[model samples]
Structures are given as structure tokens and as C-alpha cells.
Target: MLDKLRREFTLITFGLSGVVLLIALVMTFVSNVTMQNNVTLSLLNRGLEVGHALNPQMGSKDREGTVGADSMLTVSVDVTPSGIVLNKSESPVGLDEDALDEIVAKAVSGSETSGTNWARHLAWAKKSTVYGLRIAICDTYSRDVSLIRQGISGVIIFLMSLCALYAVSRALANRSIKPVSEAWDAQRRFISDASHELKTPLAVILANVQILQRSKDMSAEDMRWVGRTADEAEHMKGLVEDLLTLARADEAKAGSVGAAGPMVELDLSEIVDECALEFDAVAFERGCTISCETEPEVMVTGDKQQLERVMNTLVDNATKYAAKDSEVKLSARRDGKKAHVTVNNKGAVIDAEDLAHLFDRFYRTDKARSREETGGFGLGLAIAKSIVDAHGGKIWATSDAASGTTFHVTL
Candidate 1:
């Protein structure tokens, strides 16, 4: 039972129930204390009123009214050698004789009758009726005590009932969220299995296509179809690879974030320069100029290969889409404890709405142009994002009518 209640939903319910129970207990205690104090004060005032009526100047022995004739049932009369005393009965049992004597003596001596319990200090003076007043301390005190005990017991019962209700609510909430959890697990497993399943067949096809392309006697028409088929196969292969990479990145982040066990120190500036040099030929083929403005020594702790992939994707995107002969700048530097890498290009402005969705898998700005112009499945930035995320980095794109588009990566 304890273990079951330790689950997230149950624990939340238990916490809420505890809070409600605490509020109830506080209110009950405060209200009971206030009521008891008020009743004690009212009894004291009544005793003082009776003393006043009996003797306006309380020190003298004088009786102004008969006790029973005063029309107050609780009032009592006492005749003594010193005075005709009027006092209220402390209870139906009347006053304690010794306590009455002390009270009478105090009243004659010109002192107020004051004591701890309400019934103990009975007020009296010599009046026409010899009437005095007091309230029963035991009855008032016992009733207040009983009420407080009953209130506590009621609170306990209410808390127990709330706890049971909370248990039921928690179970219902868990059942409602269970489907989302199951679907999430199923989706993760499907991606993991599908990526593994597709790789071997893709490798075999690529191998066979390469062998066929080398044949000396193949017709031009046949070569064209073969090339198209091989390209499509490779695109599919890259998609599967990207999916696997995203899956792995998710697993790594979930399990090992902040542990930094697999991280290594590497010079980001050197890696960016190396990739720029390698992509120079491709840039030249596309009639584009690739330039690097690198800070000499920017060190970062991450997976070197993944960081290399991030640089490669940004360069490839620039090469594919940037206008002919337009400058594509790759820059890297150290900013505080973080390394910043930026790829800027003078190209057609990317749409603001499309920019947000650009890093989503298989998403593209212009899907028709993407399909026809670049032979891209639109997973490059998505893969780059996954890789950067695995290294605890952020990547975003900004564009305007004036400056074209720039993708900034901060690690």
C-alpha cells in the first residue's frame, strides 16, 4: 500500500490531502479558542454587573433588591452579620461557602473579585435584593474542552475520507495518462527497430549500384536510370541514418546529461577550418565562395565527430541554396565559457514561419524546389540539431530582407 501511494499521482494526492487537513485543523483550533475566550469574558462582565446593581458604592453592606424578586433565576441572596449579600450561584449547586466568604470580604475591602476560572470569583454586595452574579467555570470549561475534542475527531475523520478520495482520484488520473506513456514507448521502439532494419538492405543496394555503375558497356539511358535509382536509395539510407541518430541523441540526453562522461576536449576552430577547406571544391563547383573567419583557439568539450557533422550540414545547406558566386561565411569563436559557431550566406530569405520548422525532420521551406533542385530529403539541419543537442548546444536561424539568412550555433 505504501509503495503504491509513492507513485507520482498518488503522492500528489496525498500532498493535497495533507494541506486540506492542516487548514481544517488550524481553523478548528482558532475558532474553539476564540469562542472559549469570549465566553469567559462575558461571564466576567455579568458578575461585575450584578455587583454594581447591589451596591453602586460596593464597599458598604447594603441590599437594594430582593434576590428572587430581581427576575434573574441564577441570582442568590445571603444575609450575614457584616452585610446583606447578593451573589449569583456559580452553578445550580450554589457557591462554595469558603470561596463566597473570601469574595464577600474582598468586595467589602473595596477590591474587584478576580480569579482564574469564571465560577470561582462570585461577585456580591449589600443591595435591596442581596443579588449577585457568577457563571459556572466547570460546565463552560468542560463544554469547550468537549467541543475541541469533537472538532479534532471530526477533522481526523474528514482527513481520512479525503485521503481515500485522493487515492481514487490518483488512480483515475494515472489511467488517463497511461495511454500517452504507452504510445510514446511504442513510437520510440518503432523508430529504433525500423532504423536497424533498413540499414543492411540499403548497404547492399548501394554496393550493387556502385558495381553496376562501373560496367563499361552500360547504355546512356540505362546509366541515367541507374544513377537515379542509386540516388534515391542513398537518400532513403540517409533518412534512416538520421532517424537512428535522433534516437541515440534522445537516449544519451535522457541517461547521461550533466554526467559528461563521454565528452572530450577539442578545438572547434580547427575542426571548422578543416571542414571549410574540404568543402572548398564543392563550393567552387557551385560557383560559390566559401570563407572562414575563425578565432585561433576556441576549445569545447563534446563529441568531435558530431561537432564535425554540425559544421558539414551548415556548409552543405549554404552550398545547395545560396545564390551563385555568393559568399558563405563560416565563423567560430569562444564567447565566455561557450563556443559559438555561425554560418552566414547571402541567399534568398528563409520565411519566418518556415525557419521555426526547418530543424524538424523532413521539413523544408519549399518542398517542391527542395525535391527538384537539391535531391535533399530535408533532414540535414534536423540531424545537425540532434548532434548539437547531444553536445548540449543550441542552433537557430535568423533572416531578413537585407542580410539574407544566418544560422547560429552556440555550445
Candidate 2:
């Protein structure tokens, strides 16, 4: 349970951190791109303001002075409405007539006042001036290179940050769960200690009740009261035993009790068949029947007694809840390295929500039903689950109206 808590904490923290970091990185990249485009467009507009007659080489003193180094790569052209280029600016970069014409045609026909020609690594702006139409185009090679470097660096940093966050989150999760872990351990120990302490007194009570029942002087009404005491004592004893079993199971899971029991290769098929036979009379008394379909020599390595208990618990649970005149099916089969056991019964369908907690200790779907009627404190399935878990197997149940309810065990 502590392990599960730690895992969930780490995942949730790391996932949220990763998302925030990703969003920050994306926003930074987009902001940089937008800023770069705005600067390029501003340079284009400035280039158009300074006509070709005012050459920077001539050191023309104008309102905007000589164009900056970035604007030096700009190409400005004045074109008539009839697609005639009347004036053009000199550019350091070579541009053939065909390429220049293409750039001019695209800029003049563009829907937007300003846009970029990505294939040519060019940013352009168009405007209607006193001299027909003015088109300004600027090279964006430097901007593209800067953005590319930024993107690669951002990705590398994002990945590194995630790795570091994962390590830190795991550390935090462990530290955060320490108190809960201590409390859980304390509870388990208390249950183990309390149950151990109660066993002797319960045994003595039952023994005394048996002795009193044999007394010859007891009246009929007094005997009835003694019998009731014995019955209640027995029920209390059963509950204590169940709690003790759960405590031991918890210890086994934590490796504090070493191995729960001896594990040996045993025939699961035989266990299933035997369990079905043992529950035959109980099922018959309930107007239900036990049916077994076990494959021969289905072998698995586990504690034989614990495995038998699992089978008995499943079969007994099925028989108790099975509809009148219905069959409780117990089956075992070998599938490669795994042995499969299933107990199915035709009964009222268990709700999806209740199915999830069926193996939880003292969890009963029929809350209003008397424990006397079920002859259980709802610990049977929990014990079965603990045993299966100790054996490194899986146990779960599925229910539906058409197929009724089925408990599946995979070992």
C-alpha cells in the first residue's frame, strides 16, 4: 500500500511538472518567433520608406539615415498596377530576374499586407505609395538560424528538466508517505497483538459454555440462555480468527513473516475437484448444485493448504449466493506456464462499483443482510485474495446479467 501511494504521488507530481515546463517552453518559443517576425516586418517597412535613390554607400543623410546592416539585405521595388517594375534597389545577395519577378508577383498579389515567403527565407511588405505600389523584401536567414538553435536548446533543456524532476518527485514522495507508513504498520501490529491476546479468553469461554451445557441441574430456559452465549462466543471467535489471518497475511506481504507457508508443486485440478466435492452438501442444502470441470494434472507451485483454502472460499461464496436450483461451476485448467481456476455462479449481478471492493476486508455488498444468513464476516474473499497475492497470482471478479458473476484466479 505504501509503495502504491509513493508511485501515484511521483507520477502525479512529475506529470504536472512536465506539463508546466512544456507550456513555458512552447510559450517562450512562440514569443520569440513573434518578436522576430515583428522586427523583420519593421525593417521591411523602413526599407520601403528609403527609396533606391538614397543609397547607403552614398552616405545619404535622410530622416531615417542609412539603413542598418539587416536592412542592407532588403530589396525594394516600385511597380505599376500593370506589373511593370519602374525602380529597384541594389542588394548584396544575388537575385536573378526570374526570382525577382516571382517575389514581386507573390508580394503584389498577396491577401495580407505583410507576409513571409518561407521557401525563399524572405519577409515582405506591400503598400500603395505615390509611386504606384511599393514592395519591400528582406532576407530572414539569420532569424531562422537563431530560432532553430533556440528550439533545439529548448528541447534538450526540457528533457533534462523532466529527468531531474522525476528524481526529486520520487524523493519527495517517499518523505511524504513516511508518516502514513508508520501509522499503517502500527495498525497492523496492533491487530496482530490484539487478536493473539483474545484467542485464549475466547477458547476458555467456549470450553466453559460446553461444560455448563452438560450440567444436569440446569433448567430448560437457563440452558437456552447458555446456548445463546455459546453461539455469540463462537461468532466472536470466528471474527478474531479472521482478523488474525488478515494480520498474518499483511505481515507475509511485507516480508516480515518470511514465507507464509511451504510452497510445493501440487495438482490444482485435484484441489478444485476436492473443494467442489466438499461443498456439494452445502450447495445441496441451499437448493444449488456443484459442478466441476477440471483438467487433469494441472500443476502449480504454491502452498497446498492456502491454495485449498482459496478454492474452498470461492466455491463456498458461490454456493451461498447462487440462485435456487442453479449450478455453482468450479473449473481448473493449465495454460502454458500458468494454471487458471474459476468459480462461477448464476445469481443476481454484482454492481460494477461493488465488484471493485469485493476483495476488501469486511466489505459486503448486501449491507442489510444478517451475518447469520451468510455465515461469514465478509473476510473469506479478502483472505482468498491475500493468499493468491502471496503466491504471486491474480484474483478478480466479473459480473453481468447474462453471464451472472464469476471469480477468476490466475496462478
Candidate 3:
């Protein structure tokens, strides 16, 4: 149980951390891409403006409008029909001869003439002229790409930080479950000790009441009081035993199941059938019937007496709660590698909210309260859960207006 709780804690911590960090990383990358696109588009627009400023047909106003919009150096070259360059204008920082040759060759050959060089942070663009010629333009934008590179670096660092946080989160998750695990262990120990301490007093009280009832000197009224004391002491004894059983189950080691010598291989199908038959008579007295459907040879490794108690408790509860003249069904079958037992009664539907606490210790639902004559201490299901846990199994309940209530167990 402690291991299961620890695993749950680890998953919750790491799962939340991963989801939150991933979202932050995605937002950061998205914003970074947006900013980079804006910067790149600005560089391309500046190159286009420079190209338009040197356009042959541009009026003076167009040139004036283009001025001061972009201060990046640019060169415009026209490639003629014979693939010879007609240099139109050169910026103060003119393109190197090799670079000019590369751009002219691409434009004249009708290939893509717009791109950037990583080594120099230069951007280039080209446009075709009317007489089978082309004008190519190039410029430098080192500062803009440099800023983008730094922004990308920051994103990388952010991603690395998330990794570190994930690692730390796992460590914290381990530590976070420690106090809860320790407190739970302490609770189990306390219950075990208290139950053990109460057993002797309860036994002594019951023995004394039995002695008082047997004495010829006692009147009928005195005998009645002794009987009541005996009955109440027995009831308290059962409660103490239940608490001790649960404490023992909880104290089972993390992975060393079946370590206790008391458990043996049990025929689950036989137990269910016997409980159903036993309860059939009880149900018949209450104007109800028990119908059993058990698969042959269904088996589990568990304490037979404890498992029998679980089945008996479930059958008794079902028989008690089933509506008059309604049917209570008990079933046992092998489901995959596990044994499944189900007890279903046609009766009052348990509320959705009550179903959640149905197995909780001392929890009586509103419907259970209505049948006070057949009152229970409300620890039967809880004891069954502890036994199921000891056997490495699961138990749950479901209900609805149409189907009544069903208690299901897997072993």
C-alpha cells in the first residue's frame, strides 16, 4: 500500500511538471518563431525597398519615399540576354567579385536568386526585366540574425532548465510521500496495539458476565442485564478483531506477499457456492431467493477462513438488503488469470455519493440506515478490502436504480 501510494505521488508530481513545462516550452518556442519571422520579414522588406529605390522607372517621389527606410548596403546588377552583367549601381560596400558572379549566374540561368549566406549574414533577391534580363539585389543583415541567434540560444537554455526541473521534481516526489507513508505505518501500528490491548479486557468482561448469568442467586432482571453485557462485549470483540486483522494486512511487506504461513490455496468457486446456499435459507426467510452461478475449479491462493468471511459478509449483507420477493445473485468465475466474485441484490439503489464511501470503515449509507433492525458496524466491506489487499486483489461496488447494488471482487 505504501509503495502504491508512493508510485501515485511520483506519477502526479512528474506528470504535472512535464505538462506544465512542456506548455511553457511550446509558448516560448512559438513566440520565438513569431519574433524571428517578424525580423526576417523586415530584412526582406528592407531589401525590397532598396530594390524599388533603384528601379529604372521609379519617380523622384518613390526614391525619396524609399530613402532612410533601409540603410543596409545593396548592389543591383542587370544580367543581359547574353548572360553578361550590366552593373546598374553599387552601394558603398559593394559585393565582392565572386559573390557578384554567383548571384548573376543564378539569375541568368533562371534559378532561384533569393537566399542568405550563413557565413556573412547576407540576404539576396532578384527580379526579371522585360527584355529577357534580370536585376538581382543583395544586402547584409548581420545584427538582426545575430539577435535571432541569441534568442534561439535562450530557448535552448530554457529547454535545458526544464529537463533539470523534471529531474528535481522526481527527487522531490520521492521525499513528499515519506511523511504520509510514515504516518500511515504509525496508524496501522496504533490500531494493532490498541486492538491487542482491548482483547483481554473484552474477554474478561464476557467471562464474568457468563459467570454472573449462571449463578442461581441472580434474578431474571439481573440475568437479562448480564446477557446484554455479554452481547455487547462480544460485539466489541468482533470490532477489535476486525481492526487487528486490517492492521496485520496493512503491515504486510511491500512485495513479500504470501510470506505469512496461515494462507493456503483456496477454491474460490466452492466458497461462493457454499455462501450462496447458506444465505439462500436466510433470504428465503426474508421472502427473497439467492441464485448462484459459479465456474468450476476457480482458484486463488489466500486464507480460506478470511476469504470465507468475505463471502459470508457479502452474502449476509445482500440477503439482508434485497427487496422482498426479489432475487439475490452470487457469481464466481475465472476472468483472465484472476478470480472474480460478484454479489448483486435487487433492492434500494445506493446513491452515487454513498457508493464512494461504501467500503469505508464505520460508514453507513442512508439506505443502510433505513434497515436498522439488521444493523451492522459497517466494517464488513472494509475488512473484506483488507483481506483482498493481502491477497493482491481488488474490490469495488457499483449501483443504479435499474440494477440495484453490486459488490465485485477480483482475486
Candidate 4:
């Protein structure tokens, strides 16, 4: 249960954190692009300033002075349509005639536009008049590229922070569930203690009723009353025993802390067959029938008594609620590395919501009907689940209008 809590907390926290991180990443990318566009336009405008100086008809001169523009530009080469270098700007490091011709060929053959090649540390912008020479501005987008690198580093930092946050959330989740785990353990211990205290009195009462039943001279009315008392006592005994089973199962699950019982190999097929036969008479009395299709010698490792209780609980539950004149079937089969046992009964379909909680302790679908007609505390399936869990197995129930209700066990 603590592990389950930890996993649930981790999933929920990480899911929310993922959304937040995604939003942060998106916002960072948008802001980076905005910054890049602003800076690129600034650089391109500077190039346009220098080009306008050469051709007064191109556009109006820039309001921002070109004082520091030359330092930023390595070479502003002018090339003709036939790829002749007409002019080259004054710079400390200038492009060779070969490089200028190559760039001019590509620019003239391609669309007239501004572009940046961060890989080769170059930026180029072109302006052309119809049937005239093409003047191009070329430089490096060092500032814009630096901004992009910063964005990349921010993304890496976000991922690392997310991982660190996840680790912290898990640690907090463990601490948060510790009190709940303690309270749950205490509740189980109390139930086991209370059930033990009640057992002696229940046994004494049952023994006295049996003694009274043996009196030959008793009147019919007295006998009936004694029979009723015995019946009630037996019912109480069953409930107390179930509570004890659950308590011990808890202990067993808590690191095998001196469990009340141990598991051993048992023929599951034989167990199912015997249980079906044992309940056949009861089913007949209730206008129901029992049918079993058990695979012989199908074995499992489990406690014989607890497994028998599981069978008894399932069969008795089926006999009580199964539609009159309908049949209940028990079957055992081997499925891969495990064994499967199923009990099916024809009955009204259970609602999906109620079906989900059918195995929860004290959660009955029809409380009044179960109390008056079925006479159970709604712990049968819960006990069965605990037993199966202890045996490293699983148990669940499913129902539908077409197939009736079925309880399946995998061991």
C-alpha cells in the first residue's frame, strides 16, 4: 500500500510538472525567436544603410548613424548579373575575389533575399533592380546565434530541474504516507485482538447450546429457541473467523511477520470438485444447481484451509444470489504459468460502479438484502482477495447481462 501511494503520487506530480515544463519550453522558444527576429532585422537594416550609400535611388538613408557598421561587416561586395565584382567595401579582412564570385553566383541564381549561415559564420542580404546589377550585404549572425545557444542551455537546465523535482516529490510522498500506514496497521491489530477476545465467549455459547440441544425432555418451543441461538452463534463465529483471517493475512503480507498459516502444494482441481459437491445439496434446496468441470491434478501452492474458505465463500455466495432454477458452474484450467479457477452463476447483472467495489471490505451491493437474505458481513470476497494475494495470486469478478456473473482466480 505504501508503494502504491508512492507510485500514484509520483505519476500525478510528474504529469503536472511535465505540463509546466512544456509550457516553459514553449514560452522560452517564442521569446527566443522574438529576440532573434528583432536582432536580425537590426543587422539587415544596417546592411541596407551601407547599400543605400552606393545607390541613392535604392531607399532613404538610415536615421541610425553608420559609425560602427563597418566594424561589424567584413566585406560588402557588389556583383553584376554576369557575376563580375564591381565594388568591395573597406575592411581589415576582405573576401578573396574567388569567394566573392562564388557567393555572387549563388545569390544571382537564387531568390533575392536576406539569409544567415551560422555553420559557416556568414550572413547575406541582397537588393536588385530590374535588368541591373545586384548589391549584396554579407556578415556573421554572431549575436542572434549566441541568443539561440542560451535558449538551448535553458532547456537543458529545465530538464535537470524537472528530474530533481521528481526525486524530491517522491521523498515527500513517502513521508506523507507513513502516518496513514501506521494507522492502518493499528486498525488491523485491533481487529485481530478484538476477534481473539470474542472467540472464547462464542465457543462457550455454542457449546452450551449444543448441550441444551441434547436434552431429551425439552419442549418444541425451547428447542426452537435454542436452535436459533445456536444458529446466531455460528453466524457470529463465521464473522469473527473471517476478521481473524484478514488480520493474519495483513501480518503475512507485512514481511511475513509470523503469519498464522503457511502455503503448501494442493490439487486445486480436487479442491474445486469437492467444494462443488459439498454445496450441491444446499444449491438444490435453494432451487439452484452446481456443476463443475475441473481439470484433474491441476495443482497450486496455497494454504489448503484458506483456499477452501475461498471456494466456500464463492459457492455460498453463488447459491444465495443465483437466479432460481439456474445453474452455478465451477471450473479449473491451466493458463500458461498459472492456474485459473472460475465460478459462474446466472443472475442479474451487477452495475459497473458497484462491481468495482465488490471486493472492498463491508461494501455490499444491496445492504438490506445481503443482511436479511444472504446473512453476510460483505467480507467474503475481501477475505478471498487477501488469501489469493498471500498466495501470490489474483482474484476478480466480472458481470454482464449476456454472460451473468463470474468470479475468476489466477494462481
Candidate 5:
């Protein structure tokens, strides 16, 4: 239970963390782009300020003068052959070639000097005359710095959120499932205790009943009642035994030695054949025929009694549920290292929905028929599955509406 809870908690935490990280990454990317745009706008404004200041300094003879007060700016008054060249302080270059050209054009057009603080540029015309200005303007945000910041912050936040989510999810899962685990344990204990308590008295009652039934003085009617009582007691005994079997199987308990109990290594084909022969008598009484097809000398290592019980349970189920005079086909085959045993019967088709759960404990395909003919508590398949499972095997069932149902066991 704890393992299951922990697994689910881990999955939930990781799943949520993945989603959060993806969103954070996208948001960070957008924010980075926006920030870069803002930075570009700032650079443009400084350029325009330079251009504006240079505009007043431009002259026909000297060509240039100081634009700003700080060492960040230097105005070289140069009269070149074609024009006056004025360069502004170092500024971030525009992102693309087009933006670069636009910045230069803005400076040359005197837009930077006359424009707002958002943009800046250096302007040059002829050698005798040129002006520069710094202006503020609007443009798209730059992406570089914002993206890097967002990436770093997103990674940090995602890691922290994952840790927090995992811790909280684990705690929540434990709390949410604790009650179920407790109830399961309690139920298991109650069944174990109750089954234990009932065994001794049931043994005593069976002993006394048997002793009484053997007496010669009893009337025929009384004998019949005693016989019925014995049969009912045996049935009850079987039910309790099944309960114990399932309980042990579920709890993964080892089996104890007993007379008429399973213990042996034997040829599975022979066992299957014997089970089919034995069921032939009962099947005949029910107007059902039993037959088997098996590979020769297929062997297995397990409890003989339990294996017999498994086969009998399958045959009994087939005979009980199959239509009148329907054939119950028992088959066994060796495929490489494993053995497969299947019982296919012609009968009313099982519903597709029910097939998935047919092997569940106390599950019945036909509840009314189960009550009438077999008086079954729906434990035959469950017990068979338990026995097969104890022997490290598997069991499953399949049904088709046009055909019938086939139950298969692999060992």
C-alpha cells in the first residue's frame, strides 16, 4: 500500500512539474522578448539624443563640436572630401540590417535631434555641414537578455515547484489512502480470525454428525435428514475452506500438510485425463459430455490435490453453465517450456463486460443459475485461480457471442 501511494505521488508530482515547467518556459521567452524590445528602445533614445546635440554643433567650417558633457561622447570636427563624419558614443546596434539602416537614416534626417528621447542617432550630410541628434521613439522589444533571464528564472522556479509538489503530493496520497489500507487490513484480519474460530467447531460438528449417521436405529426419514445435514455441513466446510484458501492466497501464505491435500510432482496430462474421467460421471448425470485433448507426458510440479481441485472446478463450471447435452472440451498442450490447459464449453455466451471480471472472487456469470443448480457462491474460478497462482501460473477467460466461453490456464 505504501509503495502504491508513493508511486502515484511521484507520478503526479512529475506530471505537474512538467506542465509548470513548459508554461514557465513559454512565459519566460515572451518576457525576454519584451525586455529586449525595451532595451532597444532605450538605445534608440540615446542615439537620438546624441543626434539632437550634434545638430547644434554642426558648422560649415569646423564641421563638428562636442555633443554631450561626458567622456562617453567625442565629437571629431572632420571635413572629409564628401561629407562631415560624426559618430556617437558606443550604443547597442539594431537587431537586423534594416533597423540599422533606419537608425542611420534617422540621424542623417535630423529626426533624432528633433525627435523624442526614445530614439538616438548620428547624422551626416556634406563635409561642410552635418547634424546629429538623440531622439526617443517606438520599436519592437529586443529578445536576447529577456530570454536568458526568463530561462534561468524558469528553471529555478520549476525545480523548486517540483520539490514542493512532490512533498505535498506524497503527504496527500498517504493521507487519502490510509483509511483504505486500514480497512483492507482490518477486513483481512477479521476473515482470518473468523475462519480460524469456525474451523474447530465445524470439525466437531462433522464428527458428531458422522457418528450419528452410522447408527442403525435411526428411521429412514431421520437418516435422510442426517444425510442432508451432512451434505450441507460438507458444503459449508467447503465454503469456509475456500474462504481460507483465498485469504491465504491473497496474503501470500505457505500451505500446510494435510491428508487429501495437494502435494506431488506429476504428469499434467495424466492428471487432466483423470479429472476429465472423474467429471464424466457427473457430467453424464447433467446431460453434458466431457472429453479431453492433451499432449503426451506433459509434466508439472505441484500439489496433486490442488491441481485436481482446479480441474474439477473448471469442469464443474462448464457442466453447470453449458446448455443441455453441450460438450465440454478439455485440452492440454505443451508449448516449449510451459503447459496450457483450456476448457471450452458451448453455452449461453457471457457478456463482453463480464468476461474481464469473470475470474474475480465470488463473481458469477449467471447469478440465478448459480443459486439454483450449483448453489455456488461464485468461488470456483476464484479458487482455481488461487491454486494456479500458488503454483506460479495464470488463468484467463474469453467469450464470444456467436460461440461460447473458453477458460485457459497456463503453467
Candidate 6:
């Protein structure tokens, strides 16, 4: 239980932190891309403004003062609408004539006033001027490289931050759950101690009541009172025994009581068959029948006595609640490495809300039903679930009007 709590805490914390970090990284990337586009377009516009005087042979110093040092790599062209280059400026990097023609052709044919040709690492803008169609192209290789580096760095940082958050969240979860863990331990200890303390007195009371009922001189009225006392004592004893079983299950789950019992390979099919036979008479008394269908040699590894208890509890419960003249079915099968057992009965459908909490301690679907009517304190399913969990298996139930109620166990 504590492990589950810790895992949930870590996941929620790490997940929320990851989302926030991802958003920040994405926003930063977008802002940088927007800023780079604006700067590139501004350089292209400046080059078009000075189209008439953009001499191909102009020195770097002269052009630097005119359109900034970064704009030295810009290519300005004066082209006609029919795709003829009228005049062009020299590229500092010495781009060939074919490349320059392709750049001019793409810029002139573009529908937008400004756009980027990402394949060639260039940004271009065109405007109709008195000279001709003026087109400006700027190198975007350096800007693209910067953005790529930023993206890689952001990904690395996000991953590293998630790792760090996992550690921090785990530590915080441990600290947060410390008090609750202590309280839970205390509760389990109380139940174990109280149940142990009650057992002897309950036994003494029952023994004395049995002796009183056997007295020869006792009147019928007094004998009736003694029988009532014995019945009530018996009921209390059953409750105490259930509380002790739960306490032991709790201790086993917490790993404080060592192993629940010795685990060994056992034939699950035989156990199912045995439980069906044991409950045959009980089901008959309730006007229900027991049916068993088990695959031969179906096996699992678990404590034999505990597994028997689980099967007995399930079969008994089914026999009690099954509709009159209906069948209580018990089946066992092996599927690869896992074994499956199911106890199904035709009876009134358990509501969805009640089905979900069926394994919770002391949870009954019919709250108005007395313990005498139900013949249980509602801990049988919870005990079965605990045993299954200890064996690293699963147990659950499903109910509907047509199918009635079915309890399933996979080991």
C-alpha cells in the first residue's frame, strides 16, 4: 500500500513538472524563431531599399556601414517580371551564376512579398521598384544552426530535469507518507493485540455457557437464556477470529511477519474440485447445485492451506447467495504460465458501485442486512484479495443482470 502511494505521488509530480518544462521550452523556441525571422526580413528589406547603389564590387567596410556586417552575405538582384536578371550584387561567398539565377527565379515567382527557401538556407523578399523588380536574398545558415543547437540543448535539459524531479518527488513522498504509515501500523497492532486479548475470555464464556446448559436442575426458561448467551458468544468469537486473520494478512503484506506460509507447487484443479465437493451439501440445503469444471494438472505455487481457505471462502459465499435452483460453478484452467480460477453464481446483480469496493474490509452491498442474514462480517473477499496479492496474483469480480456475479482469480 505504501509502495503504491509513493509511486502515484512520484508520477503525478514528475508528470506535471514535465508538462510545465516542455511548455517553457516550446515557448522559448518559438520566440527565438520569431525574432530570427524578423531580423532576417529587416536585412532583406534594407538591401531592397538600396537596390540602385548595391555595387557588386563594393568593399566590405563600405557595405558594413550601409546594411550591417551580417548583411555582407546578402544577394540583391534587379530582375524583370519575365524572369530576366537585369543587374545583381556580388555574393561575399562567391555563389555561382546558376545558383544566383535559381535564387532570382524563386524570388520573382513567389506569391508572398517575403518568404524563405529552406532547402537552400536563404530568406528572400521582392518589391516592384522604378528600376525593375527588386529582390533581396539573405543567408540564413548561421540562424538555422543556432536554432538546431538550442533545440538539442532544450531536449537534453528536459530529460535531465525529469530525472532530477523523480528523485526529489520520491523523497518528498516518503516524507509525506511517514505519519500515515505510522498510524496504519498502529491500527494493525491494535487489532492484533485486541483480538489476541479477547480470544481467551471468549473461549471461557463459551465453555461456561455450554456447561450451564447441561445442568440437570436448570428450568427451561433459564436454559433458553443460557443458549442465547452461548450463541452471542459464538458470534463474537467469529468476529475476533476474522479480525486476527486480517491482522495477520496485514502483517504479511507489510513483510513484517515473514512469508505468509511456505509456497510450493500445488495442483489448482484438485483444489477446485475439493472445494466444490465440500460445498455440495451446503448448496443443496440452499436449493442450489455445485458444478466443477477443471483442466487436468492445472498448477500454481502458493501455500496449500491458504489457497484452500481462499477457495472455501469463495465457494461458501457463492452457495449462500446463489438463487434457488441455480448452479454455483467452480472452474480452474491453466493458460501458459498463469492459472485462473472462477466461482460464478446466478443471483441478484451486485451494483457497479458495490462491485468496486467488494474487496474492501467490512464493505457490504446490502447495508440494511444484518450479520445473521448475511452470515458474514464482509471480510472474506478482502482476505482472499490479500492472499492473492501476497502470491503476486490478481482477484476481481464482475456482475450483471444476465451473468449474475462471478469472482475471478489469476495466479
* Maximum-TM-score candidate: 6
lDDT per residue as tens, model 6, 58-162 = 443444354456667677889888878888776675556766688777767767788776777878889997655898888888999999999999999999998
lDDT value, residue 115 of candidate 2: 74
Judged by TM-score relative to the true structure, which candidate is superior, 1 or 4? 4
TM-score (C-alpha, index-matched) for candidate 4: 0.82
Report lDDT (Cα) of residue 144, candidate 4.
56
TM-scores for candidates 1 onward, in order: 0.57, 0.86, 0.73, 0.82, 0.65, 0.93
The sequence of per-residue lDDT tens digits that candidate 3 reaches over residues 354-391 is 88898888888864353237556788888888778777
Q: What C-alpha RMSD separates each model from the true structure?
A: 10.5, 3.2, 6.7, 4.4, 9.0, 2.5
The predicted structure with the larger lDDT, 2 or 6, is 2
* Candidate 5 off by > 4 Å: 1-168, 253-271, 295-308, 333-339, 370-372, 389-393
lDDT of each: 0.70, 0.88, 0.74, 0.79, 0.67, 0.87
Model 4 residue 178 CA deviation in Å? 3.5
lDDT of 1 by residue, 1-411 (tens): 122433766767767877777787778777877876566555444434444244223233335333331123123334343544543333343446676566555544544444443455332333223333232221244545677687878777877878687878678667766776667557767896899999999999999999999998999999999999998998888789878877666556546333223578899999999999999999999889999999998998887777888899999998877898899999999889898999988888988899889999878898667565776777788878877776778999999878888999999
- Candidate 5 per-residue lDDT, tens place, 273-352, comes to 99899889888898889889999988887888888889888888898778898899999999778989999999888888
Find the candidate with the highest lDDT and give its number: 2
The list of candidate 1 runs beyond 4 A from truth reads 1-177, 214-218, 254-262
- Sort order, lDDT high to low: 2, 6, 4, 3, 1, 5
* Model 2 error, position 123 (Å): 2.8
Cα lDDT tens digits, model 2, 10-94, are 9999999999999999999999999998888777888788756435454445578665666676778899866689998876745
- The true-versus-predicted C-alpha distance at residue 319 of model 1, in Å, is 2.8
The TM-score, computed over Cα atoms with residue i paired to residue i, of candidate 6 is 0.93
- What lDDT is reached at residue 143 by model 3? 52
Displacement of residue 209 (Cα, Å) in model 5 is 1.7
